[model samples]
Target chain A: MNDSVIHIEGLHKSYETSAGLFPVLKEVSLHITRGEFVAVMGPSGSGKSTFMNILGCLDHPSAGSYRLDGHDVATLDKDALALLRNRTIGFVFQGFNLLPRMSLQDNVALPLIYCGVERAERHQRARELLVKVGLEKYFDSMPNKISGGQQQRVAIARALINRPSLILADEPTGNLDSHTSTEIMALFESLNREGITIVLVTHELDVAQHAQRQVHFLDGRIVNDHATLHTEASL
Target chain B: MKLAMLGEAWRAMGANRMRTFLTMLGMVIGVGAVVLMMSVGQGAQYSIKQTISAMGSNLFVLLSGSSSTGGVRSGSGGSYTLNVADAEAIAELPGVQAIAPIHPGSAQIVYGPNNWNTSIIGTTPGYLDARSWPVASGNTFTDSDVRSATRVALIGKTAAQNLFGDADPVGQTIRIRQSPFVILGLLSTKGQGMDGRDQDDTIIIPLTTAQRQVFGSQFPGSVRMVMVQTTTQEIMPSVEKSMTELLRQRHRIREGLDDDFSLRNLTAVADSAAEATRVMSLLLGAIASVSLLVGGIGIMNIMLVSVTERTREIGIRMAIGARQRDILLQFLLEAIIISVIGCFIGLLLGIGGALLVELLTGTKVIIALSSVIVAFGVAATVGIFFGYYPARKAAQLDPIEALRYQ
Candidate 1:
């Protein structure tokens, strides 16, 4: 637990619907140490999304403990949780959530704005990341002007802007073609090789092969957790 | 951080220019109406104050009682009940500052080849003191001028202009009813009176000269009216009561009989006129404030719609670690930018409208700096006040639910 990036125990999450209390995650426990790239995989309504939300500190579990980067998220208030997420975890959503009105550089620098970074430093850091993502020439272009793969690359650059300990990608390549998905996975693999921990949620078996380990969920429970056996073959 | 948020707010507004402009139109019209109405009302009040000051302060006009011949009564100044002695007697009373015996009429004056008809006032030198008038170019007629019935006269600006054209009238001789009178001084311009009459289109001469030498009064030393002034406004009531009692006693009238003269507190009349103008300005401001309120409501409505429309954007910001306060600040800043920019535009439009009104109607309009500051302050306050609810609603949104919203 000393070197763990994500530590959870008996985590339970439920939604109060109009009819009754609907349980999504029940009695779940997971531990992911630093520098580990893990994939969360499940069919629809298998609670993988809820588990990823808890790991990202975006939502609190109904009952149990969740410690992300050494902070007990359940004990934190809403603002504190937001701060924790800003400083410790980065999120890449299925929909490339780049603000439509902002330029690509501004979209990448948005997270720094919440943490009170100065404009010149934010611009410099965003430029570095956009260059790292190979979209440095399109810094001033709007998100709509970029292709799906390029927008996703920009989203990845935005996720890495704050240098967070953990990258939480929910279907990071969900909207991409197979070739584009392979490129995104290669980017994630290169990032993970640089010692940043990544926790991605995807149902595709080939996408999950990129991660060092894969955790599978079924009926609100983890049914399988194992190291990938076909990483070399898939690559 | 706030400055960055303001930039974000500005871009957000720039995203939908048409919607933003329509929303800002309400504030524009509202602030425009307020500024314009305030300017017009202040102009009216300022003109009234000028008129009041021109007429004089703490003044009273005592008109001689009307004469009745078999129930056909004349006006208050139609009889010779008031005279120069009565004015001198009133001067000795306590709280009395100055007194002027006046006999006024209209007559044709001739200077060289120019002949013009103008008002002629026969008054003592105290009239200038009571009216707070100053000589513009030459000396005023002295008390000795009145006592010896001199033909020295003071020419008003309008009368001087009409009689002498561009030439100096100080030493020129003007004939009143064919009797030559030397112009002693040029009285300063008083512009227009409250009754819309040109106060500078008149002349002033010695009371004795007007009564004896010019008009030839039947009763010696009797004048048409007496103008009295008190030392302070607070002493006017007591002075009026004492003067009434003194006049009644001096005239030897019985207790139940009416006095032989009528006294009017000109200051009170002027004060009421000023008060009426004050009320009128306040009413105009209140009416304009209603439009401001409607504009504020319009801002609130648009902000609410904006919040609703931008729910998904809010969710996206929250997902990336934006706190509730950040969201709130962003939206509030948007609202404030819209209103403040609208207020600035409205200020320009209002000043332009006021100047246009002045140019069209030839009315005086004053756009005081304090009024501009107040309009700006109120507009900013209205923006914050109306933008609060929508901003708070955006702040309190559930991130998970907002993220899922289409």
Candidate 2:
């Protein structure tokens, strides 16, 4: 049996707004295998973001069973969910979300620090990841000192520091120009070829096209899922 | 895990150097002030008590009035006359070690070309022993002087200093209010009292001479007041009761009439003063403690701002695999560190400030180690107590939403 990284059945998430019980995710069921590069696309309020949150273990399903790495999400308490998130998932944000006060190396080492890695070992792992992201020369540079594209590269390096099973990127290139967006997407594709599973959430078609599988979402449910032809060799 | 979290917290705090320092300043001042104030207050009280106790055991003053707490008071008539015979009568009572009737008056002392102002106290031979007055030179007034109403007098150090100037005052003859009197003795110096009055600015003469020759009053054989000493502190009440009964019988008070002469216990008075001072110091400490609370609130305010400002950083950490407790603990630890450091600085500054006050003012300041401990403990408690809410807020944040924060 191919090991499934995440399995969600009939996931329902409803938010209490002034309009009352507005459903963000309605009867959403999906399964993602380990080592798959999947992209989710949708307009605003399409529940794609909600799905990403659930997949990253940052939130629990409202009324559904979410089993991540074969462990049930509902069984986890607040702290246990946090531990699962820390141990199994890594995240990158659209705005890069690099802490401006921290050096590139520190930013990359942050996840490993949360994972309770020793100082020297955490530093070594962060350095290796930074080198992989072509940020070896900029290890000591602060987030603000680097270009938008380079900051995103640092963020990606941070996401890989814990060697997480799944890498979650939400609007990873939302703030970057087209050229930088292509570069960051290419970095994601290269990371995918190394056998790390990726679940990317974005509204942009060009950014979504870089993944092997693309799922479109509308009104809190998946509308269509299509296979995309892209690999590290093509990039 | 603990060390790593601590390191992360330190790094985060060090990142905002100015904010951390400013936040710590409040705790520093508060703790310092509390420690310093308590020490100084305790010192003042201790010194005062020491001065009182040095006056001797169970020394009391009996004055004629409705109420007189101390020797100095206003708006009262001297109704009871404590005469030499009354003094002798009190001396005969059990537990009464010594009794001296004092006749206080002012006079001018003239020796050679030097003349000086001085208070003249006329009493029996036991007067010196009662008041803890030690003779420095010449002999004190003998019982013969009391009977003969002799013109010989014992001069205090201040009187000797003023009238005789470096010359030996024992053999000198000084004119007291133009009446020539031989200085038979020179008394040793006793420092200033709690009332800031000089204890060594007087001349002692025989009680009979002061009553007959100086004042020229005869009826009832009136005297100023009597100083009484008990054999021991435990027998004071019985001594007081017998003396009161004797005086009352002499005065012929009706069945329920209050005694005309009022008795004052020096030990009780000293104890009361100490209690008052203790209460005053406590009040001062309480007022100063408000600053510590304010400091805690200040820490909370800054922590709130810090949590909000670091929302994205919190998200990033959470995404990286940080437990909610880790994030919470990080912020909480930072707040605690700030408070603890503030307390330490406050303690140092407090002690320094107290010393400075003492140096400048010549006031006794006691630095109690307990105060230092209290300051530090208060600071630490403030940190933990006030830092909880913000830490919880930071911990409960959604990673996805926090990451989306621009």
Candidate 3:
């Protein structure tokens, strides 16, 4: 428990619709240890996306105690939660949410701006990350001027700019082709080997195979949790 | 961090240059009109003050009674009911500082070949002291000159310019009404009178010289009008009352009979004129401020649209850990930048417009630095006041819902 990066017990979330209180997640509990890659699998209405939002600290659980990197997320105020998110978690979305008006370099340096980094150091770090992601030539290019794969690379670079302890991705390759998706998964695999914990949501079996462990959700409840057979066999 | 956010804001505003300029147009016109109107109004007030000061302070003009000849009555100052003796008596009163008895007329003035028609003021040496006027060159005519009824005169600037050109008029002789009078000194210029008359286009000579030698007064020692200066403004009413009573006694006027002279408070009339100009200046500024209000509203309107259009960008920043204050400051800075920049351009335009007005219409326009600072300060405040609501709305957006916005 002390080494765990995320620890949730009896997490429950609900929405108040016109029909009344509609529960999305019910009595679900999970834990993710450091340096581990976990994939969450579920259908569209199985509460997996809500679970991802909670883990990212973007939304509050209706009735649950959530601990992220040993901080009680439910107990923290808005500003404290923002600071925690800045320091501990990085998010990559399916839409590659890069601000369109900013250059690729500025988009990658966005998180560092929140961290109060100086402009020179921000540029230096962003340059290094862009070089690492094979986007060394597109530093000043606007986001719309770049391809989808290159834009996703910039988003990943932004997620890593703050040196977060955990990376949370929601269907990161949902809009990418198969070849591009494989290349992005390879980047994630390499990042995991570097000892950064990663949690991802995906319905594709092939994408789930990239993670060491898989958790399946059904009807807002966890139905299975186990190591991937490929990983087990390799071990 | 703030500098970085400002850069981001600049880029965001640059993204829609047309909309930004259109929004700033309102501020541009607002500040421009305010500055121009303030300058013109202040210029008018300034000129009025100059005229009042040139006329002298705490002054009164005592006009002789109108003359009735066969049921056709002439206006006030038509008869010789006021005299030098009455002026001397008024000078003995408590608040009387100085007195000058005047017999004024207009005649053709000739110096060599140059001739001009100008008004003439025949008064004692006390007239200079009462008007607070100084000689620009040479000495003033002495009391002995008045006693001797000498034909020595002081030439005003416009009279000197017309007769002497650039040459000094002192020691020169000018002919007034075909009589030679030596120019003893030059009176300093007093640009214009309250009645739009050229005050500097006149000449002053001794009262005894005019009454005895020039105009030939029907009643010896009597004058048409008397100019009285009071020690302070507060004692004017008492002095006026005393002068009236003393004059009536001297003239042997019966009870319930009208006085032979009437007094006019020049200071009160000038004060009212100044007050009217002040009110006009305020009204002009008030009318211009309406446009400023509209400009602020325009900024608010555009900011609301920008906030709605960039909802997803706000969510992206929030997801990367931007606080509410960060988002608020960003949008607020954009609004302020627009207004301040627009104000700068408007300041230049206003000053240029004032100069153009002065050049074309020959009207005075005073562009005071304090007014410029006030306009700039008000514009910045309007930007902040109107920008707050939209910025707060952007800051309070839910990151989850904002991210999902199309």
Candidate 4:
């Protein structure tokens, strides 16, 4: 019951510049159990984007021992890493990167298609996810043709299509108005309460308040980790 | 995966109608020109060959005015050069089928009230067999008529129509240059010659009659040229060689000196014409194919731009679970679709062009099914050659960076 979904030990990353190799993350280590709701908060240059990239399997650390769902990600080849990412991780970007040409339903069905799901079943699953994300009315609406809040809702629906073990949202509500951001955060809280592990990267304190645990970072090192007392753990 | 990718390709091309059409225009014109030119050229070749073959394959014309080499004219003014003796000598050679000594000139013929200017060819009895002339109404002149200089004539269909329109004019009298001659027969229609000359606009007569009455030839043994027919096509070379040797020795021409008379082998002339046409067709086809290559490059250029434009879309698909091969196949399919559509349009346009030329110019055009197959195959190959680079680029794009694209 104590299976670690994501584990990192002594992870470090740096960017080679004209000046030198400026380090982004310095020996960062963390672990999250299955179905845990974890939120990360930091200032602008705290290396949270790089950390989210590694956690989402979009990139690998320069030097680290990192494992996701028990697979060693640092040792995997690019194609293999892509497969691992597709199977175990789902991503929600701040931009709500739904294909501008496709409808909301098609955007949701994209992940299922990559997962090799049958066409009819993929459509059925996408429809169910759209309804769950309160976008049943806009199933056929294109991303560009919809409001910003509706587009983000469709993006969240797309992230759940493959039924991945981990949901990685990089500032999922960063582009939304305050009311829409609160609504999206509540939706993420409800999904977390339903036994889905949520790892979110954010700079907004109000958005991070919905998480059960918040880890603060400064200069690429964890400065504090604490549970909020006002919000009781539901699961 | 293939079907899905093909669907995506169809969708992509459909979304950008004008760009897709412009890209395919080069291929269309290339294939269209190749088909049209080849079809028309082959058609003309076939038509000419058929006309020449109909004129009798056995006939070889001997011209005395100009020698075959260097366009050299041997004698100054010609009158009564060839005679019955030379015709007999050609007839006596091995592989010789028949020989006709000819003296041809234009003259005005008047029959009753109608007057027509037509060619007058004076020949012996052998001219009928050598030229494959069929007597449609009356009898050909006998050897006695030629030897005795009797004034008898055989008129062709055109001459018959002009002089004796809708009348049975056999055994009637026609005056050639104020000399009266009896019409012995009517020659059958021979249609037009290979060089577009009217074969039926002539009157045939005994060589002696033409020499004595029509042309007023004072010289005894002279004619314009001699016509020879070989027994078989295979032995024409031997007959030609012996005839040339005999004529050269008769004319006292030494080695390395061009002969005084040119031997016109109909088969050789036909072959050269065919070869010239074949080479012309090949040159035209090669020039037209450059557009096809250009069209292939256009496909590659457009596909590369498409990959760059859809970088994030590709990244999202990759992140979701699509493999590198999937992205590669998608773009490759798009290129192939464009080429295939272009090929179809080109095929139609090419056939239409050929048919239009045939109708407007009165030229026969043949459309071979193999041209369609070849056009399609060439287009598909072009697709593969041009599609590789763009497809590979799509496959090599980094998903992480692509997903971050704004």
Candidate 5:
């Protein structure tokens, strides 16, 4: 590949708790190409969430190098990093973190507003994305007024509204029912088919089975990383 | 801020209308009080100056000093040395407009069943011009009236009302000291003077009649005082100086001896009153500014609370790629908007309050435009001064930490 969308080498993160420095990630290296769907899995202390946070540019690595879209994460300032994230990466959290007071369409248009898009175009693009996610009927409904599954769909639409090449979802289906989880996984699969890269962190193996590649972590280090033909076959 | 950013602030305020209105109320009270104080002060000064000018713009009085005789000290004005001849001498001086001699005494007037006891001022026809007093009805006494020692009188409004009821006092006969005198005119109303003395509670009669009939051989040709009116206000100082010199020379008082007369300028008295009003205005304004400071503290408290309440919102905005400045601007704009609205409300309240003060106190209230601009500017400054810390706190929030904040 000419340039990988996300490349990590020797990534490390630690927390300064009262007990002492507690290491979360230890020298974890991963490369995710454009148009690829990868799944990250581990036990509770595996630091999968920490690794996801590092990839999303929301947290700084203690001792490592991370390059997102050819820009060194450590070298960029907070504002420049925010701009890079806005242009290149979209994040979907397990909480379906749509602002409660905003309407579904307004929630989807949040990213465009940060990028200084004009009002008319921001609304238009948000409406188009809402339609793509089958949320056109709830365009004006507050996020609190919607179902958990519907809120997650709105999050996904928000994440894709910026036309980002990469999506980072941490336990995206963690709060949804199995039926809704499957529906969301199907949406992810369809998006992956459209030449969009996806990296999701999940604890369930069945949910991980939707990805073309699976990486497992234990004790803050990646123990197994492999491609599975059957995962793609099932899709 | 750009339109969208301002809209966001405006919408945020709109979301909690009651809280926003309450916050603005503090500023309104502060600014409104400041304007009201200043306006009332100015109004009082204006009314006082007007009263002074109406009484007499360029006026002064010369009173006869006391005389000592036979190694015995006499009371002030006990031995009259200044007389009517001295008044005529001063009146002929350059820049002098008119001079009226006064012979003041107490008297009781009786007309029909009504009786009123009042002060009697015996003066010439020039007294009205010298004192800026006009005849409200009938006519004033002429030079011939004074020459003949006529028993004609001009009654004051208060004296007339007390003695004549609803009947016209002019051309009517009233008895003073059991002597019936025909009324020449009713003196124009003078309300109350700055000294709290009722100007309209006394009557005016010719000096000759007062000296011959009222005093009746008490002090012939020796008037109590002379009121001098200058042709122009600018010539008052010169007139005062020239009159003093002429009186001293005419009285033949030695250079070492104290003169037998003193000059008092009404304008000087007015200036002192105006000075007191100026000091009062500043004092009131200072007291009012304290409330503005209290209002600023109110803004700081509310802004700090708002920042805490909106932490999650700040986190979400940060995650959506907003810069720190963008977050700061949004919150700061919200503060400015609140204060600006408060300033407008304060202006209305200030004018309304001034009108109310005027109605209650019967003093005119003038709202200075500069006060509005200054109050508005100070209010905006208060907003920025108090709003900065909260806005900075919001902007400095760490995205992950804020996102995890409940």
Candidate 6:
């Protein structure tokens, strides 16, 4: 779509292994528009993680181009790309990746620290986001002191701290129980309803069902890109 | 980045409290050792100067230059170019307060069954005035003692103690070289000199008595050295100049030739000795700096381990939009903070160590603020130098690789 916030064209990635050259992604092009909730699903060894890495600006594509928020990701320098990522994108890992030494509020306020936000204002926003995620009581608690579900919720609060338009959650509920997973999926649905674009990676079809659009990856290429029949009301 | 970044470093350092404390201990001991070494050395130098200048700071000795026999030159002080006549001339010069023509002789002093080997200095009454010494309990020698060439003598406190025990040596007869000499008085105690020699282990007698009685054959007007006392310390140079001119005129030495006599200032000797001590202090300071270097290496070692241990954390920060420079600064700042804290603790420990040294050794150790400032400046520089590798290692990590680290 012309309103695409993330536009990928002829994207490719490779690794120079000791065994020689190894190609991971081949001619994988995808577009993610604003305010869209999308799921990227694939089996293990299918280069799904590699694709996610490139999309997060944590890795560079060997060839071809990828654009995020209308900025050319391939041409931007490391610092400029970092600035773009800081302003426009947030990440959620399967491990919940909350800094264990920090309090929940501080973990949530971490992204804002890079943004040069004042201390009081960062804490204020972190508190507000925590309350929104039903983690108001755990604001001062450390991540390891809380449950897996609470940690993931805190991570989501962290992702939203900088008010980024796009969120990339890689298996957000991968380590959570089935019940906690559904609760997290429900939270993602609510965030999606609030018009924030989210692109998540999951192996479970049940988790992928929560997104409005599902893109299936096989052998490093997209095999299926279609809208999901399930709605937020169903979840 | 933000001031918030500094909080992260503080918290990170705080999280490893035991390790932090151990690391800081190295710096503390290093700096303490350096400061203590320098201060104690300085104190020793100060005391040495004081002791060297104790007798008479402006005292000047006119020593005869070396004499040549055929070709081999005898070292200075072995020659007898300086005589009583030169001393008499130097005494008449302006700014000359007192002059003592001293001739040194060694004798076995025997008081009843007690016998002791001591130096016998034959000088006039002006010697006591030049030395600023007063008789502690008895009278000094008179000018007639030198004129009549009497065998009467003045004993030093140490000699009196050794020969007469506790009994008063004054008015008692002490036999020297088998000749009975009455002890006129006991000289005051002057303690040990700069060269660690007992200043009071001697006796004073008339130059005429030493030449006629002790020497048995030496010339009547011969002197080993002449001690010239100036009226004021500031006029010492003028007195020395006049004395040199008078001696040269008396010796009939030609121009463009070395004088047959040389003058040595005790103040100059004291200053050179003090300079040697100052050099020793600087050497000790340099040696102590090795400990600071070792301490810095400890910091680098721990910082590297920290970087490796927190690889995943670094990845998370990068993934969340922390730039490479940010990561670099975070780790670098952490190292700097550790060193800064180490330096602060070290300063206190060093000052305390100096005071403890002074208390234990009875030496006054002075702590210069400039030394503290230099030590802390070195610490900061060391932190930056040693911390760079590990901080760079953290900053150079690929986010993808770091996140994948276990």
Angstrom error of the Cα, residue A159, model 4: value is: 2.1
Please provide, for model 2 over B194-291, each residue's C-alpha lDDT reduced to its tens digit, 9 standing for 90 to 100: 67788788889998888777655654466768889998888988888888999888778888987777788887787778888899889889988999
Which pairs of residues collide in candidate 6?
Answer: none
Q: What is the TM-score of chain B alone in each candidate?
A: 0.95, 0.81, 0.93, 0.81, 0.86, 0.72
lDDT of 2 by residue, A1-235 (tens): 3489878899999888998888899999888898888899999988888888888877777898988887888988877777777777887887787777778888888777766678899888888988999988987889898899999999888888767888989999999999999999989989898898999998988788888899999999989988776556566
**Estimated TM-score for each candidate:** 0.95, 0.83, 0.95, 0.82, 0.82, 0.79
TM-score of 4: 0.82
Error of 4 at B379 (Å): 3.5
Q: Give the CA lDDT, 0 to 100, for residue B345 in model 5.
A: 95
lDDT of each residue in B181-202, candidate 1, tens digit only = 9998999999888788999999
Model 2 stretches with alpha carbons more than 4 Å out = A204-210, A223-227, A230-235, B1-47, B54-57, B64-85, B88-98, B110-113, B124-155, B164-188, B204-223, B230-239, B250-252, B257-260, B266-280, B343-366
Candidate 6 C-alpha lDDT tens digits along B175-230 = 99999999888888887787888989999999889878886534457777888889
Interface RMSD of 4: 1.9
**Candidate 4 per-residue C-alpha lDDT over B125-235 given as tens digits, one digit per residue, 9 for 90 to 100:** 888888788789989999999989898999988988999998876899999998899999988888888788999999999988887778867566766788899999899
Q: Could you tell which candidate, 4 or 6, scores higher by DockQ? A: 6
DockQ of every candidate: 0.75, 0.57, 0.73, 0.41, 0.43, 0.57
Q: What is the lDDT of residue A21 in candidate 5?
A: 100
Residue B86 lDDT in candidate 3: 90
Q: Cα lDDT for residue B405, model 6?
A: 93
Per-residue lDDT tens digits for candidate 6, residues A157-235, read 9898888879999999999999999999999999988988999999999999988899999988889999998666674
Candidate 2 CAPRI classification by DockQ: medium
TM-score of 5: 0.82
Clashing residue pairs in candidate 4 (N, C-alpha, C atoms within 3 angstroms): B80-B222, B81-B222, B82-B223
Listed for every candidate in order, the interface RMSD values in angstroms are 0.9, 1.7, 0.8, 1.9, 1.8, 1.1
Q: Model 5, range B79-119, lDDT digits (tens) per residue?
A: 67779999999889999888898888889889988888999
| Residue pairs in clash, model 1 | none
